[model samples]
Target: MGKLQQFLTGLAACFGAILMGSLNVWPSYTLELYTDNTTTLLTAPMSEFESSLVGSLPSLGAMLGTGITGVIIDFFGRKRGAMLLILPIILCWIIIEFSSSSIPILIARFMGGVGGGANLVYAPIYISEMAEPSIRGSLASGTVSLYCLGALLSYLSGWFLSYGMIIWVNLSLCIAALVLLSIVVESPMFLLRQKNEQEALKALAHYRTGSTGSKSVLEELSLMKQQLLPPVELVSVNADAEANEEATEKEKLNTDEVVVVVPPKSSSLKLLLCACGGCVRTGANRRAAFTSNASCRAFLVVGTALTLQVMMGMIAVQVYAGTLFKQAAPDLSAHFCSALFALVLLAGGTVTGIVADKAGRRVLVISSSALVALCMGALGFLMQSGVAPAWVSAVVILVYCFCFNFGAGSVPYVLLAEVFTSEVQGIASMILVEWVWLLNFVLIAVFPFMKSLMGVHGAFYVFACVAVANTILSYINIPETKGLSNKQIQEVLHPKVDKQNSIDASLSVCQKAVFQEP
Candidate 1:
């Protein structure tokens, strides 16, 4: 494929990723409006049994669905896993649109949550695998950018259309997802792991050449196949060792095959510790040398960045913006406030994508976090003092939004994924994402209560503190990750002691297995 075609393909993959991630945000955007209206119309307090039941049921269902779908993602290919999710999401929207009672709407929302959970897992995997390594950060971060776009669009739709129209709009999104899937190929990594050489070749060819067939493509396919092939000698050695161990154990038994076996007793704590210490002395001592290194520091920074970004971007801004505006201008419409917030968020994400590669990840992270902190502090002061105008509040919030996306919003995943080796990349990514979701859940659930108790000014003071802490952490710990390959990042993160021990341990194991094999 030509450079243009490859870029377009990458763009499509990014767009798809964004669309999939958007499913996760729809519930958040609409829940407040839906719950408040339902409470008033039912002639009950928001926390009354019936009102709370109707309002909270969907989120409960979504949480349950998210748990189950997270496990299912490992078995199904990312694309197929995501595709499976669309059905339930579409069904949920349909039910929400047509149902009269709270029960049906709750059920639909729960079902949609299942799909959203699956989408969260699959979208990043698909985009990262399909994109060229040179632009992988941009492509991966595009998922976030697009996700914000989806959330913005959802808010816009809700602001302009009736509740019924919003359901139809969500359904249309699911249908559009299905159509897009038909054109996109499965992840090459998934294909390789499945041992589908021909399919993997086809994917690599399409990814590299864009055209179906050519001499150059064939050569590249051959090289990919060779590169992906397993080591037959290693397999042979493992099998031989297993067979020899079985024979040796059999030989130790009586010829009559009447050997009595005594059950091994469990060791006491003292004995277990002694045995463990002995094992450590016999070369397992290397693990102690693996204490917090550059990589570990990077992980910490990345995780913090992720936590703060989601907190500031969606939870803080979406939940509190209208209230803050209302404090300044009592007549400001919720719809108008929400739309403006969404536009600022979209702008932040869009600008981040354009300059991230050039400005570098670490610099953007520190600078952006600092800027957000400053804006947040200003907003808080404005809210505390009665002298600030509504427009000042909005302008400060926009600055906060822009600075956030440019730094914290964009760099977390890129840093986490790039800092680890391929062997541990999946685990690292999972840890970062798990934290993201956990923090998001906490921020969303407690935000209203926090705002009520602290007021808008105090709430923003908390956010500013978080932003400042995040900035300091990034500056001290996270290294520049731009223009560096994954291996290089890993090397920078792992200290000499850890690196040497790892090498020695791996070599020792390989040598023992090789020399002792039958």
Candidate 2:
């Protein structure tokens, strides 16, 4: 029952993910419709430049949406903020359904991008908060799996349904998603942060499928409080010490026993740095988490993973699936082949979600990334030689999709939500996701130019190289985070200094002191 309730909430989040996935591939199938001269749906056939705008504009809008996620999620609360975020998607479809020209549809796509970008952060955060640690990886990755489901559905819909019908279908799904989100309770952690203890307990109980007074529910709530709140006694002690120290400093100044000197340039620089770090938090816990060396290292890992994830060419393939298929297999139906690609994504993501807890994040990512590199390298050879059978190229592409999703598609997101404490999760996620959207915009916008300049084989070669590098990095850097609590993960990231290193440092200090005294 506890798992059921959590699944239901995750299912709500999945609905939004589905919309994002569909939007991602919408241009893949619809670009032809707008660009075809015989089509009556547009004022005129879209120019090459206009078509690229249609395909890439959402990513730019996503950047804007991701940048503002901390503000929206923090201000509105996760549940309500997600519900409010759905409004833009709904509005996006409405504009598309009514508009006859490219400009309004472009505007609508940007709005949809905003909703999609926010979901990239919101769904992972919401699911991670509501799920038990045992099942967190599955629920989190399930969202990505479902995003593939959305893309698969969109491919089929675009193949079979009319443009107007596709618009209405998405609109209906948006309404259904909003309804599901309403049924779920607010995130228990969000409530705890807001200091609504009673409500937090109730929310936790709802998710746990137990009464607030139950031992399991109470214990879990207590654990969340411990993780999120600073120790009150420690805070008070620090406050009193600071007060006494300030008084002593004032006395010294009055007696002329000490002189204070401030450098304006250094003071201004220090203030700027502090203000930059402080933007994420005002509380002690959040400030420490945001400014910690451990968090910075984790961010570096996530950032590099995210860069590799984008550079590996999945976004380009997803956005241009039909075109790629048409090029590779002129005899096969491109639409069917594109749907096949999405199906592979769905299968790989679902399998990853099911086994992530058992196999662990590091192993899955390292092994699958190696396979991705192999398949991509094979595809490049097939494309460059022009001698391989059409089926060989198609098979290699499908295999690449499956291998990419097996780990790369979903694991980094799990890491993003897992590595940070709740204090800095919102801001950290925003910054990382914003980076992703910016990459999406640049890659998607330039992919056509790249294909024209370097040829498809060249692009595949570039992606293969990136996948190889990613595999190496994941093997060396990614920690095994399976079944560990957030605190345990943090300890792994920021372990205690070795006793031998500590002793050697002490001896070195003593030696320095002796030499200086002489």
Candidate 3:
């Protein structure tokens, strides 16, 4: 896309990231109200389980939301899919504004989670669809970088604002995101899939060149069609008409002949079961298999990269920052420490966005993970040995924030979109996003118990080990995809195709496998 249009698209995506930040750190500030001896809710402070649920239920809601977002976007279009998220967020804030009891607060947080989940799934997909190859990685990562900024805002507001005032500010943000997203053009990919090629061309021109009447619009449209379309079976005319079909008859297309696989409106659990079942199902797995070893490796690289992103414990830190800081330094204020952590994270994400297309994905992920591991190990040692001062945990957390954001935080979001071809992108993203949420829930839910078992120090020691393993895996597997076209990346992944041959061979393999009846 042209610079101005690209900027607008990135801006819209970044707005969603900001909303995600609010959802992310929602608990960090709000939970304090219930847990503090200064306050009373439902007659008493939240018990451990209630506290855990209050913080973790949003993840449960997010997991559910992301599971169905793909089908919603597929059927309703990305713009509408994003707009649908706004109501829940607004409702969430409204409920929070009026809530006097714990139950209403819990429900409000769940609603916020629902909105956050959609933002996470849709932002990368929207940015990837709208961006050109030269700037794709940079733009896709920008959403997450903005997410860090949003988190910073969340922490700052949580620290300073009363609950009612914070809800109003968040409500305003939700409305703002809704207005911005409503005006953006529909995704060109969705238009083409619906067989509205003329409109798709207009969108491409508007999105890419900032004009629907540009002279080169058709050329760009043709390139898009070439990359996405393949020869396919069409409805047959009567044999008598068929004789004329090859010679003089106009081509009759049947848009209805296309398969529409809108998955049932199910929660994340059903989706996970369905994904696993599809893995062993005969035709489905074969069709979606990689085109060649390189492609297979590329797929593995990205899938593992996202998983490693979760396991790195960065997100867990976001969710449980208050708890960790409280344990690490009793003398320091948890609220202030968490805010500082988020600020460092925001800086890291900014640096990652500037450097993503230049420094490349592999080196950053490895380097970031390595530094995180070292810091985690050091923090664990200090806490365990009792030789550490109270300030040590704060310093280590700041360092970890920088390390995590520099690579593990932002790059995975970019690659999540960049990894798959257009054909398999939707399913791949749905599954991967679900995986991320599931892993996030497990880590956060078990974290306090882990602390009980091993103390906070031992808990971080385990995280340090996971970080070390992730560093090794990223170093060995990730391919650099800085500035290459999707088509070129496809070729790199599925090298079995003749270098001269286009997407046909790869599409043929995936189409049959991707579309088989379940």
Candidate 4:
């Protein structure tokens, strides 16, 4: 296969993964409403605790699901792990659609949450591994786009159908997803790492050549052999070291000129600090500092961006949109208005992916923050005046969603995944995703009370402040990650600072004496 073919196959696989993964989040928007309404219609009276429990159970389940699945992605391999999740998701959908009681519904949603959480970890890792270097940003951005699509689908379903119908529709989507999964190939990296050389070669050939003759297959195999060589040598060294130091030395010698040198225990802490510090420093601390610094900064920026964006966009809007809409247009249906809010969110997420790679994450985030703040400020003013038209209110809300997704929503996951080394990619992505879910939980829980106490307009003004803060932080603290290699991103995020003079000034007599000895 040519480069374009390889890219297209990878892109197809990524799109599929995201589509299935996002299927998990689509039900969240309407699940609470559905649960509450269904319970009230069926039972005599539902308590506040029961209502809250039905609404919040899925999120609690999702937190546990993601935490457990995050640690297992690297072990099970991304493709197999993802495939395993489909069964539970499908089963959950079936139970939710057919089961009678609220308890069954909660269990079903919890099972679905497990699938959703696993998808959050697995889809990005699979996409990042499969994607070509040049188009990786675009591909990574697709994951968020698909997630938004899921949200949109949920909103549309709620707008058009009853609760039972929504459940059936989701069930159908999951069934179709399972059928599609059977055709997709496993990740070549997983096979290679497992020492299934023949299978790995076959998979790579399929990825690279589509279908070719023996000579071409042999050529591809040769290239894979060379590419797989470093890991093989490293594995041998590790295995031999477990046997004895002398065996390790012999194995290292056998690996031609490549030497596997293990540093002393005393150097480990410096290595850790340097790795965690930033990416630009060189010498012994360079590799450690580079990976550590890059991953940490990326996590901080991406996690903060996701948390703030979702808090402002989904949490704030869900809590206050009804009051604000009523104040702006007493005649319009609040349910329809909420559905419109969801549509704008979908539009923002979908469109942002189209331009994110070209515009760059830092620029997109900063610009989006400014736009969101503007729209939010306008929303506050218009709500306070009580004179804004329904159409005007709708436009402002749509524009707010657009700006939020166009900037922060599309960029966070892409930047986080791209800014880390391959060795820690799974764990690093998990950390950021876990933070996103946690912040989402906090925002969802607190926004209603905040809105009640502060009023609709006041709540939005608070979100606007957050946007401005995010913009300033992006400008001062976050570096651009677009089109940069993981190592290069690490370097950019942690530019070198001259600390030698400060060190000299702060040194104590004993430290100075130690420095003199060095």
Candidate 5:
């Protein structure tokens, strides 16, 4: 068995995500600095719009960063693209340290958001590519778990440290992460797709070699190469020409002659793109690598599942957990409840890291989402009824925190990395990840108003409804990806052909067939 060397560098790169998660709740932590005259850091306390903008701008910056991530990562390479962000992150801290008013802080947070947004895109994508399928989901889920660790640390600092102190501490962590990131090797898969086979093999061997000998590393590399080039069925190929090519080519051939075409024999970057199904769609011929119908279904499953997870109010919980706790139990300290909420988030994420690969993705998502809905519904009823004990709200909310973080909360991030083929993974991740930021901004912007109008109970009721919808959607649409290779995932998504669940069969296309050279 290979030790998890890939996980260390990937996790180091992901340390920047802690910056994103911490900055998200930055406004909430610093709200009192403006509201309290004694601690006032500003000349004049901000108006609601300014306060909200402080929170919203980071999200907007995140959206901007995510929109361009595909271009930057693909063009500059992942490690280089990530290194370029250190300057902005360092700059964001400098601006915040000198901030005497809302404007400087606003600019700082937005710049920080750019780094935060890119963190989500690169961390998960990098890890998924680094690990083998048997351990891939678990390692990728660690990103989300470590994000919770960042949140917990932020909450701790908020309780005892000043806002300036918090900014300086985060800056130090980013610096340390940069030093660690310097040692990271470029992704082998990325090297392979760029047609740098020798470098790709070297990187792959570095990650894959441990107690295992050189032979196992070579086998893993070959397997990865095979997955990079999937086979297209005869029926799928002929579907593009609508029988026109079949008849025209038939005239030049006899019935005994079989026109066999496979993907290119050379390890060209173009062939890698064709294998991904994304760039394949760019041709005049409409048949994608996995075929069009399968592509559509996979898209819908990922898009709808991730969108629903946000609609269920996970962002609101993360952003406003302290405020919501104040409403739920007036006797308890808001900061204490916030600490507990984050603690549960960390614990739940730890559990996900352990269980994700063992249990299927579909069951975890459906079951956890449903459980969250029930807990939220019960909490709303308890609050509305005016009879529950203060301790009950804490108990109810802690359970909700755990459930939400486990699957409904983290699976979307995992699936976003998993669902798309390599050809479109960059662009697809940009869109989906940005969508997360967009939803976070909208939900946080409206949350105070929603709470004022309906009270906390009413808002919880709305969240519970969305959670219910998420559970049903997961049951109906999401496929289990535990222990399955990308080829297996493609097979599950594309069921139009009489395909079997053989990883070797799907990967053996090039070895089995011949391409008609142009």
Candidate 6:
């Protein structure tokens, strides 16, 4: 029952992703329709500038969406924030359905992009927070699969459906997604942070499918509380220790014996210094994630992975797949080949989600990155040599898509979902996702220039090099978070000192300070 509930929650979260996917691909097929005078969809056939805006407006809106979404999710809570995002997408379809002019349609596309951009940030965070550790990766990876499914739906819809019909279909999808999102439970961690312990427990049990009083659910809730709310007594102890010196000076003038306030039952100042130097902390007992050394390091690691994910040319490749297919196989229809491309992407994503937990993140990312490099290298070599048949380049491109999706395509999102402390995950996701959207805009814009300057083969070589770099980085920096709780993962990020040793050392220092000869 817990598994069923979790599955439903993940599916609900992915509706945003589905909407985003369809938005991304909508321009691909509709651009020609809007520009052709024969089509009755627009008041006038769009000029070159207007048509470009129709296609590019969404990216700009996505940039705006990424900027504000972090605050929304944190303030409104993930479930409500996700549902709220769907409104813009619904409005997008409605505007398109009623408007005959290109300006309104262009505005609609931008609104759709806003929703899509928010999805990239919110869906992963919600799924990661709600899922049990054992299946967290699998559930998080579902976003990619469902996004591809949406893209595939758009491709088919554009090929067969009329303009008005496509609008109706997508609007219906957005409405349904909103309805489904309404029923899923709020994130247990968010509930705990609100100090709603009983509600948090029930939410966790619903997702975990355990009794509220069950040991597993209770233990998990306790860990969450430890992370969310530190002990108030420890803060008071620190306060007392600071005032001890003033008290001692006053007592020295008034009494024969100077009373000393013993330190709290934790580690000494020296141990704290050592842990700080080592960048280790025990659970969420640390400072804000942005201020903490451990979290900063984790951010660097995730930032590098995301940079590499974009540099590997996944977006550029997808955008240009039809061109590549047409060059290599003139016999095959480009639209049909594009549908195949979307299907292959869906297949790779599905496989990753199923195997993510069993295979572990590090292994999948490392191995798949290496394979992506190999395929890109071979594709570039074949295209350059001109000795291989045209079909060989086509086959290599398809294989590259599969290999890329197997790891480079999806795992960074999984890592993004899990790496940061909850304190900073929202803002961190916004920053990193904004970076991704910016890169998507930059890469897609510059790719044609790159192909012209370096030639298509040269661009492939560049992508190959990026894949190799990512492979090395992932192996060296990324920790295996599979089946690890948040506390355990943080401990991995910042190794804690031995509790007994820290206590004994702290005690000895306190004794010496209090009893020394004067």
The candidate maximizing TM-score is 6
lDDT tens digits by residue: candidate 6, 1-518: 99889889988987788888888888888889889978688878998899899878888999899888877877788889888888998999899889889889889999989988888788777877888888889888888888899988998888889877888899889988988989999999888767788989999999886799999899888777766642221111221233466564344334443344333333322223333444233323222111234455566777888889899998878776777788888987766887888888898998889999899999989998999999989988988899888888888888888888878788888888887667667777788889988888899899999999998889999999999999999999888988887767777776344777544343334433353413
Candidate 3 structure quality by residue, lDDT tens digits, 342-400: 78887888888788888888888889999999988998888788786756776788888
lDDT string for model 2 (119-200, tens) is 8888888887888777788887877898899989999999999888998889988999899989889999999989999999
Candidate 5 Cα lDDT to native: 0.72
Better of 3 and 6 by lDDT: 6
Computed on alpha carbons, the lDDT of every model, listed in order, comes to 0.60, 0.78, 0.71, 0.61, 0.72, 0.79
lDDT per residue for candidate 4 within 233-331, as digits (tens), equals 111222223455456445533544333322222232343345555433443432232233554555566667767667665555755566656766778
Over 4 Å off in model 3, which ranges? 35-49, 210-216, 231-299, 315-333, 452-455, 495-518
- Candidate 2 TM-score, C-alpha based: 0.84
Report the lDDT of model 2 for residue 294.
50
Candidate 5 lDDT, 253-306, residue by residue in tens: 333333444543332233333434443344322223333334456666877877
How does model 6 fare in lDDT? 0.79
Candidate order by decreasing lDDT: 6, 2, 5, 3, 4, 1
lDDT of 3: 0.71
Q: Which pairs clash in the backbone of model 2?
A: none
Clashes by residue pair, model 6? none
Error of 1 at 418 (Å): 3.9
Candidate no. 4 TM-score: 0.76
Over 4 Å off, model 1: 2-73, 210-301, 310-314, 329-332, 420-422, 445-455, 498-503, 511-518
TM-score of each: 0.76, 0.84, 0.80, 0.76, 0.84, 0.86
Q: Name the runs in model 6 displaced over 4 angstroms.
A: 231-292, 495-518
